[model samples]
Target chain A: MLPLPVLEKAQTELVNYADSGMSVMELSHRSGLFTDIITGAEQLLRDLMNIPDNYKVLFVQGGASQQFAMVPLNLLSNSKKADYVNTGSWSKKAIKEAKKYGEVRVIASSEDKNFSYIPEVTSSMIDPEADYVHITTNNTIEGTAFQNIPDTGGVPLVADMSSNILSEEIDVSKFGLIYAGAQKNIGPAGLTVVIIREDLIGHAPESCPTMLDYKTHSESGSLYNTPPTYGIYMAKLVFEWLKELGGLKEMEKINRKKAELLYGFLGQSAMFQSPVQEDSRSIMNIPFVSPSAELDAAFVKEAKEAGLETLKGHRSVGGMRASIYNAMPVEGVEALVEFMKHFEEKHAQ
Target chain B: MLPLPVLEKAQTELVNYADSGMSVMELSHRSGLFTDIITGAEQLLRDLMNIPDNYKVLFVQGGASQQFAMVPLNLLSNSKKADYVNTGSWSKKAIKEAKKYGEVRVIASSEDKNFSYIPEVTSSMIDPEADYVHITTNNTIEGTAFQNIPDTGGVPLVADMSSNILSEEIDVSKFGLIYAGAQKNIGPAGLTVVIIREDLIGHAPESCPTMLDYKTHSESGSLYNTPPTYGIYMAKLVFEWLKELGGLKEMEKINRKKAELLYGFLGQSAMFQSPVQEDSRSIMNIPFVSPSAELDAAFVKEAKEAGLETLKGHRSVGGMRASIYNAMPVEGVEALVEFMKHFEEKHAQ
Candidate 1:
């Protein structure tokens, strides 16, 4: 979900952007107006995240799912071997895609516990000769996240931070590359944001598809071939909203409060419980289960009727999941908790 | 440019789509509302284009540039070779990308004439064993278009129709696949519309990225991953606008009238001349030139001051280009022609 103000601002400028007499979607990608949008977007993002000068920010399409393939296609040039942490479904998909290009070793995994927690990673677990180490910083389906960034010695660390990027402050120097789909904390669904160190830009093999090469995008400044113009405009508005809300540090405090409000209720409730471990819980997606499948179904149905939409869990996991991303107000969590309390009282036996 | 009516409708629904209390960008892809959106969009397109049952419409991402590699990666399984016709810049890029995956033969080319016209493609020029024959049906940079769809003798014709897909009526059965970037005649830049015959699906090798494979998207109904939900919704609005305005046949007539207004002026004007041959000219993009570069610069600047934007020609082929897409009204073309006449009179030799 986007910040309400961002959506409203976009609505105001939807038809005639910046008095250009054309919708953002209609502007030519090479036009000066669009160039300013993309350039301002990148600058705003860098300011919000405190990105380093050594990192190149690329706005591309195909989401994080495409990045699953691209991360390997562009980075497996050294040893052609990588270590991956299998935290949940997204990690497994990334690992599978990476295996197509090189040897992928699962250095650590939480699958033995139904992906309820993030597996610990240390420098010792990583292959020194490996091209890079991959991890999913937050698993949207499994409701787990790495509580701490792992150290990989000198190896480049690649992360898929699709669900939880910009939720809190982080050191830009912690990883060699970071990619996130814009659907979550960024803006919309079509655009993917990639931040990669300059050294990692040109490693793709010569046979790599030009579109899949990081160097191609980096060289062209992400304008290689019409890089999702409208989505970038939306993202710029979102970044403006973030800056107005006092950047990630302030956003993180509010997010933590929202997560605590819901999790505090779940901890005390008899009818509902969080499926994830305490320390590994994701601030973005919080999955919970009731006493029975029927109860779960009733909870999801009633939640929708109460104006809380998309409360259903992924089919792979049985119960209900609450995806309270950065855009979810604290009152939204309070409302869900209040609804749960009333339901618990009514369903008491 | 998108139709003004469509942009207005999108602005009205930008924040609370269908009273769902969420922007279309915020809606879950799996939600019933979004399902209706994607389904309605595909149906409307099918109705407007008269697409056959055997053709599957897949809304994927990464634009036509990604399709440059995907076409060969998926279709080169049989003969490890494909035939391409060089029309202009886009054709050259597509050929370069395809050559990375297989042997790409340029059987017909208008490059000898500076890509000012479409070359004739006969069945004899095609390698019968070629997996498919590729062509850029509309060249945006050079302002050329194939007046006739070349028959490939049952060898499956593929087209990159990015600049002119929805502007006219065409027989879908003649092409094995048709891919267009949505920014031109469709809704936005992020979404790519791929109309492929069923027989051409499932041909990608196992090593191909899941996101790049046609069968992956076709089988999942383009829901294998989160789509560009907002773009799809906008396209649905565009389709609705087209249907309300009588479909492609009516659109084609209006488009022809707009092209005539501008081209007829170019034909009669002594100061300005169209670079393209009359029969091979595109109704979508029209490139014209003045007697000198100084005059061209003056005309573009004067046109912009008169509220005509993006009329400057592409850098590779300089002068002036007025891209009158499906959304350009007859009045807009008339205004452009009127401005041209005034400029020509003031600069009379």
Candidate 2:
């Protein structure tokens, strides 16, 4: 969901951006105004995340899935191998994409348990010669998140935190790169936020497509080609919004409070069940199931009628998921809980 | 620039899109509402372009530059060569990208003339063994356009119509594929509109990155992953607007009128020089230069103050370019011509 104020701001500036007499969408990517938006986005992200001066923050397109291919194309060439922790479907897809370019070792997997929890990853599991150890920090489909980042020894840790990037603080220096598809906690899709260390920028192979080469984008400051201009403008606003609200730490507080209210109700409710383990449950994506498939369907339908939306779980999970991202208010979570209680009282089996 | 109607439509629907109670940006690409948006966009484009039922309209991201790599990665693998007609910077970039994947025969080039004209591309100029013949239909910077599509015999004619697509009528069935970056006449940046024949769909090499593979995206209906949701939605609106405005032929009429108004003035002006040959001049982007460099600078600055924006010529061209695409109204052109007349009267000496 869009932040209301941001949408209003964009609406007011839809036709004319800062007296340029054109929407941000209409500005050339090479224009001074557009360059400022992109660079300002990077700087805001850096300020909020405490990203080191050495890290190159790229505003890219094609989402995290493209990054799945780009990461291997750019980095996995040197080592010809990478360790992948299969905690969920997103990681599995990343592993599958990485295999097209290099050898991907499954160092750890919670797939055996239907990806209901995060896998226990250790340095022993990592290949020392591996270029990077990859992980999906948050699983939107499976409703799991790594509470803390894994120790990859000297190997770089690459995380696809598509659903959880701005919800909490992360040490940017710890990972070689962190990529997030900007639809969840960020502003929109089409914009992929990639924060990669300087050392990780320039090792792409000859076969690497220029667009896939991190160095090309990093060197050009993500202006190598026409980027998602309006999306980047929205992202800049979201970044500024985060900063205005006292950054990620403050966001984490609100997120935790929101998640706790819903999770607390789910834990105590007799009719509902939280499928994820306590430590692995995502504050951003909360998936729960009713006692029966029919009830789960009914609950999803009824919730939508009552104006709580996108509550149906992913087809793979087959239940319900309340993806309470940064934009989801505590009141929204409370409303969901109240609806769950109302349904439970009426349809107590 | 974004069309006023499209931007206003997007603004009205910015927070809640068509009673879905969510921004188009928030909708899952897999959801029915978004499926309708993408498919609706395709159908509208198909209708507007009179595209054959055999063609697949894929809404993609990373702009036309991504297509530069993707085209060769998918098409140039087996034949190992593609004939490239270099008209301008965009085509040169495409040639550079295709070289990474296969041999690119420079069948013809207008680079000797600083890309002021489109080279004569005859059927004999195309290598029979070539995978495809690549041409940039419109040169945005050089202000040149192909008045007629080149015949490629049995070979596929691949054209990059980034600056011209949807602004005028073209026979879609005459080419194997046409890809356009949407920032020009289509909608906004980040969305690429690819209209490819069904026969041209699935021949990517084994080494192709999944994101770069046309087959992956085509088979999945451009939702192989999260697409540029809002951009596609905006494109859909633009397409609908085009359709509502009597489609491309009608757009051509307006575009032609606008271009004529500006070019007609420039042609007769004693102080200004039209750098391009009249036959090769683009109705979409028209570049003109004044008597001196200082006057050109003054004109651009004064034009900006007069609300004529982005009129500065590409540095390579070193003049003024008034890109009068479909979205540029005739009044805008009239205003520009009046300003030019006023400026001329002041500095005619």
For candidate 2, give the docking quality class from DockQ.
medium
TM-score of 2: 0.98
Chain B TM-score in each of the candidates: 0.99, 0.98
Candidate 2 structure quality by residue, lDDT tens digits, A223-288: 898888888899888888889989999999999999999899988999998999998999999999
Model 1 ranges off by over 4 Å:
none
Best by DockQ: 1
For candidate 2 chain B, the 10 contiguous residues with the lowest summed lDDT are B72-81
For the predicted complex of model 2, DockQ is: 0.80
* Tens-digit lDDT string for candidate 2 (B155-240): 99999999999888899888998999998888888889898988887788777888888888888888888889888888889999
**Model 1 chain A poorest 10 in a row by lDDT:** A203-212
